[model samples]
Target: SERIFENEKVTVDTIPLSHRVYTNGFLFREKPKELGLNVDAVKKYGIDISHYHNIKKGKDVLLDDGSLIPNSELTFPPQKVKSYAFCSDTAYEPGIIPFVSDADVMYHDATFLENEKHLAEKTGHSTAIEAAKIAKEAQVGQLILGHFSTRYTNTDQFLEEALTEFQNTSLARDGKVFEW
Candidate 1:
């Protein structure tokens, strides 16, 4: 249940999950860009604004004094793009493992405890353990368990359960801020 929308510069994937009816999760990613001109290097080389675009596109620039400034000297290496995946209100879906593999951060549904796994399955939700298993299998940098069931009074158990499989697992709460 995945649909992909892509162009020359970006790709957005919508993953539809099985809930009581149908729900979708999205993954957004940026395409790699050409080497960009280093501002300091541009200033050092006394390059004009007109040649800035050319240097960013990896083209050498010709100086007014009949000297050639190599593109390598004017531009910096491209930066690595970070990726994130959000699994919204899904069951223990192994099918999505490939799409979200090796993501920098992953947020998955953890709506119930292991004791209530039957209810979680019936409602098309996942327990903390299930979410952690998915994170482990995907090899994500960080695993965030969210969407806890309101029936639970203490949510610390969710984090504890998730930690059994993925040491990097964390429980998400309202107003909680996560930094990469």
Candidate 2:
């Protein structure tokens, strides 16, 4: 519900989630980086390293000869920015759509299957389909379902049901590691 960290490079924010107790999710977003310097262009222009800072900051350079060099010609675009969202120990909570919309990746709680919807509701947890619906509504790049109930003998249904709504959904396991 509030931003916890921020600088020129990135930001981290908390999102309130529907749970029996006080619960929150997190959203981590990387800011657009400075433009990359075209070393070949710099060398070709005979520009000194002293002007590197200003050029990267998007400033045009004025040569000693009074010739002007555009910043666009000195630097290329930056890398793509990325965002991540984490929601757990919570219910279907569609109210969080705005905060997580367009996230590159999202990890959501899916503690039950559709057959146990009543149990999940009572426990303030979400079913696999509900998590997938949230991911689809938010248009997130990927959905990671986790926090399963111990009673379930198999987790295939979770991935299966979630995939029906969001094709990029994946299951989270105890020792599993995810990148991007």
Q: Largest lDDT belongs to which candidate?
A: 2
Point to the candidate with the largest TM-score.
2
Which stretches in model 1 have alpha-carbon errors above 4 Å?
1-11, 33-36, 64-68
For candidate 2, lDDT tens digit of each residue in 1-180? Answer: 799999988999998999999999999999988899999999999999999998998999999999999999999998889999999999999999999999999999999999999998999999999999999999999999999999999999899999889999889898999887
Residue 166 of model 1: what lDDT?
A: 94
lDDT values for all models: 0.86, 0.95
| TM-score per candidate, chains pooled | 0.82, 0.95
lDDT of candidate 2 at residue 16, scale 0 to 100: 94
TM-score of 1: 0.82
Q: What is the lDDT of residue 132 in candidate 2?
A: 95
Residue-level lDDT of model 1, residues 80-142, one tens digit each, is 666778898999888888878888788999999999999999999999999999899999899
